[model samples]
Target: MAANSRFSIAVHVLTMLAKNCDGRVKSDFIAESVNTNPVVIRRLLCSLQEANLVVSQVGASGGTCLARQPKKITLSEIYNAVSHGEIFSPHPKTPNQDCPVGKNIEAILCRLQKEIDKTVEQKLAQYTLQNVIEMVEREKV
Candidate 1:
């Protein structure tokens, strides 16, 4: 399965906003940084807003900012906000079930995927938005 770009983009946008927390960060600016279209940024903002990760304001000097302190948010939170499907997905067009392995492989894959998801979630839970921001800062960006 293809990984969603939204998760990475959201993290980048949110990290930028956290670094420049004195004011709101414009979606346009975020789009520029991500090298994507502004519309993409807006769409992403909608999901982040829904997840309570960012708050948007409208006016001459309006933009977006993290809803809570950077330390309060988590990478998993951002991931969940934009990642609509499972971290991994089986083939939509089911594999042929004539063969024993083919029939049982789907079930085995499902179980293994669940285990992987749990491990990933546990690791993600340990890293907050602040941790990400700090890393960005340390990287001199």
Candidate 2:
């Protein structure tokens, strides 16, 4: 399966907002930075807003901004906001029941998948948006 970029995009959006703490940013500008369309950015923004990770305003001079300080927003929160499905999905079709490995592989993989998901969430929780911004700034030097 193709890897999804929503998580990274959301992080990028939050990082930009954190860097520009003085003001809100428009979706067009964020799309330019992300190399994606403004519509995609807006959709992601909606998910972030629903999760309380961002606050958006509408009007001629309106845009989006972080709902809270960067240090208070964890990567896990962003991940949860944009990721609607599992990181790894099982095969589309069921495995052959007659085959021993195929019969049990799904169950085994599912158990392992759950562990992987938990670990991913835990790791993401350890890094806040501020941590990402620091990494970005350090890389610029």
Candidate 3:
């Protein structure tokens, strides 16, 4: 299965907004930078807006911009805003009870999955959108 990319894309969109800092950015411009369709960027924008991370406008000069400063926006906040489900999905159908490993696998994986999600969230929470912009600035030189 394809991994979910909404979290990363949302970060990119916000970073762009943080760096721009002066005016609203159109989704098409952000889509070009992200190399994705404008629709995808717009969808992510909707989710971020609902989380109060970004705001949008409509009309000729209307576009999108960050709702708050980059330093106040944590990566995990961005992650939670877009990531809807668990990182790992369980089997669609029940494994055969006839097999001992099959019977216990789901329970075992559930425990592991919880730990994994916690670790990931904790790590992501360490950084903010400002951190990302700094990294980009350093590398751009």
- Candidate topping TM-score: 2
Quote each prediction's TM-score.
0.83, 0.86, 0.86
Stretches of candidate 3 off by over 4 Å are: 98-101
Tell me the TM-score of model 3.
0.86
* Candidate 2 weakest ten by summed lDDT: 82-91
Residues 68-122, candidate 2: write the lDDT tens digits.
9999999989999999637688989999999999999999999998888888999
Q: Candidate 2: lDDT over CA atoms? A: 0.92
Summing lDDT over every window of 10 consecutive residues in candidate 1, give the lowest-scoring window.
Answer: 82-91
Candidate 1 lDDT, tens digit per residue, 39-116? 999899999999999999989899998899999998878877987436678978778899887789899888988888
Compose the digit string of candidate 3's lDDT tens values, residues 113-132.
99998889999999999999
Q: Cα RMSD (Å) per model?
A: 2.7, 2.1, 2.1
Residue 125 CA error for candidate 3 (Å)? 0.4
Evaluate residue 129 in candidate 2 and report its C-alpha lDDT on the 0 to 100 scale: 96
